[model samples]
Target: MCISRRNESLNVAGTMRRGVCLAGCALLCAFSACTMGPNFDAPPAPRAERIEHGEPVADVMDAAGAAQRFSNDATLSRDWWTTFGSAAVDRAVTDALVANPTLASAQAALRESEDDMRAGAGVFYPQIDASFGASRQKYSPLRVGSGQPPVIFNLFTLSAQVSYALDIWGGERRSLEALRAQTDAQRHALAAAYLTLSANVVNTMIAYAAYGDEIAATREMIALVGEQVSVTHSQFTAGVAAYSAVLTLENEKATLEATVPALEQRREQAGNLLAALSGSMPSQWIAPEVSLENIVLPAVLPRAVSSELVRQRPDIRQAEAALHVASARIGVATANLFPSVTLTAGGGYGNRSMNALLSQTGQAWSAAADVTAPLFHGGTLWFERRAAIDAYDQARAVYDQVVLAAFEQVADTLRALENDAHTLDADARALATSEEALRLVQAEYEAGTVGYLSILVADAQRHQARIAWLQGVAQRLQDTVALYAALGGGWYGNADG
Candidate 1:
């Protein structure tokens, strides 16, 4: 039978012959099963040194130091500013979070990067679209069937289409990985910015507090010196003291008077900075007044441990993430070497007559698939791959530098903590000695047995010793803060998760 012969030929051509279409499908299946690029693997973690120098090389403070340990929580929190334990500091931080312009800008950047990452991921899926259109055409009336009109009827078409580039080589997947890494990098970046902002807020507050304290102290000193100067003038006029001595006393009073304005100016500058951090008016918000008497160091401070630092430092994490992004880019570049298959399919129905619009006989459909392979391009793809390699190398270098810097920071902070402990002890001793000497000199001056210069020198020594003691305390506090920063903790509120 003719029907049976046609069926036999159809089966032979489609099944026995297995032409290019079938072969292409098989090849595509193979491609889909095999990724063309390298698989991503994380780099080895760095081996860090165990002990930092100057960390009680002897066994004296072993028990004291061992009681405190740094945390290894992967995610730091939003309220790191409360570590200072000051309500005013808490309020200031809240204000900054709410209104600080720089933070707002950084937040916007984070959001943009997050959206970009989402978009990059979304592209991996198949794209689908639906469209509808209608049109009318005109024909030459004289040439068309001799009895036909000049105008042609309207036709309408509606259809849905879908297309997807098979990510056979994991090219798109790697691109998504790169985007994900970028998102985390931005997250870490935002964390670093927040940390810096908190530090600035605290530093400004500390400066303001110290400046105010110094101003009050200087004012008292000035008033006392002025009184001393008046008393000395009376003694000189009464022939009890030399005129030159009164002039010297007057000069000292004048110098003390000058310090008041300088301290006030510093206080004002600190206030302005605090205002900026709080994103509020300097005059309206009172900078929380603090003093050496009020500051309470942690009962025990956590020591810097290398393992803890590497795991917690936002900067180091950010650098590592950058490396990830770069590594993914190599995959992206390698993927470009393979061929691309773009599947485009669009089908629609059209009918000139309104009554035939719903008829299957008048419907039309179409589908197509395209494959493109790069033949030659002056080695542009090669250069792109090379550039990707270069970027990976650069990221590696930056990661190396960041980790090295972290180690160095811890080492230096350890050295500073050791030295500052000694400095505080020495300053304490010096202050005590100066105070005793000042008391003895004042007694001798009241008895008229010592020269004014002796009393003046003793007073100067006491004042200098007092100021140095306060400054040393402030330095130690700041140094301690820095030590915690090096350890990647402390200013971080104690809420570890």
Candidate 2:
């Protein structure tokens, strides 16, 4: 500042110049405090906006009907996976929540974000430090006494200096805000990870259950095929049935026997996967032998409106929070282009003698505001601003994708539930018909009218029916899990921002 003395000849131009400088400083402070980058406008919900039309399923089915009824309900039950009503299944899900590696990893990330928030917030507070040290120094002869005598001295420093950023430009404030948003996002991420873990545990349990039924069906078919072979052998020995009939019976038994190993292999594989999900050693973990056929599927499912996903789904909210952080970052980068003002004031007392350190003569005090403006940079500031704008655009796109993907998953799960239930019902009917057909074939063979081969073919049809029914049961269970995940119901369902 060109401080012309008050007594000197002060002109209008001089007064105007000082006024302009003050005004410019004030404006810089104001602009630097501004949020410069693209503001985070929440992405539009095109699919959810027309949810009534957006839903792909007709409301006639029980699954869609439940969804229509609970559109506004919160939390959707923490044990959504346990709706299957099996104590064993409930135990499995609980174990996974406690032991799953993925959830542990996500939890660690959330803790890290919390630390980031603390570190960022620390910038707003004053920093105080004290230094104490003892040193012996030798005075230079030429400087002290003109080569008369060298003096040995002991020195120590024990002063506390406190400094604070003042947040005059609000840059630190904006940065801290960004960190807080990131912490929220990390929390949501933890919730989403939990949802995934729960779904996997449930799905793996169902898969193991289905394989159990397949194993039983295959064994039953093999035994029945053995019975038919024995019947053929007796007839041929009695000179009633042909050698070709016996050959056919042997081939059917062989095919049934082949199915046993494949079914057992699949069951073992499912058990191994379940062990992994539960974070247990496969060598030590043994999945319970459960039948898919006996497991009761949920009669009613939780459903909610499209907008409910934005509030409930952790992944979508995580994405939205991340966008908020990114938007705040733009303000941080923009603040760098303006002058920064920091106000600092401190007072202290010191002396060579400890007793005199408390005297007024040793007292010192100071107060001043340091104003700094950017003099030069190699286009770093401009590029950073442009980058902030680009980051906002990227974050917006990610938010949109997260929302759309969540909506699409819900639509897909609902459709699967409808279709799989219809299929399971049809397969049940087919099983009944197949059993009846075998009965008829057995009666005809007993009357000596139809060949034993006819009974063997009927047995094959019965086995196929049982396999199909078991597969349908498995599909229906997986569809249920999919629906729960698709709706984005998890830990965040009860979370309040």
| Candidate achieving the largest TM-score | 2
Model 1: lDDT of residue 160:
77
After superposition of all CA atoms, the RMSD between model 1 and the true structure is 8.9
Give the 10-residue window scoring lowest on summed lDDT in candidate 2: 63-72
Candidate 1 C-alpha lDDT tens digits along 1-497: 99999999999888856777756854885556555345555455566555465344221212212222233332233554455566766766677667787888778888998999989988778898987777897876787558766777787777778898877666788898888888878877776777777767766666666776667666666666776777777788889889998888789879888888888898899888878877778777677767755654433455455655666677887897898999888988977877777887876666776667667876767678888887898999989999998999999899989988988887776666566666777787898998899899989989999866576567666766777666666666666566656655532334321
| Tens digits of lDDT, candidate 2, 47-80 | 4443333445554454312222234333577678
Positional deviation of residue 347's Cα in model 1 after best superposition, in angstroms: 2.3
Clashes of each: 0, 0
> What is the model-wide C-alpha lDDT for candidate 1?
0.71
lDDT by candidate, in order shown: 0.71, 0.76
Q: Model 1 segments beyond 4 Å from truth?
A: 1-32, 36-45, 50-83, 139-151, 353-357, 439-460, 490-497
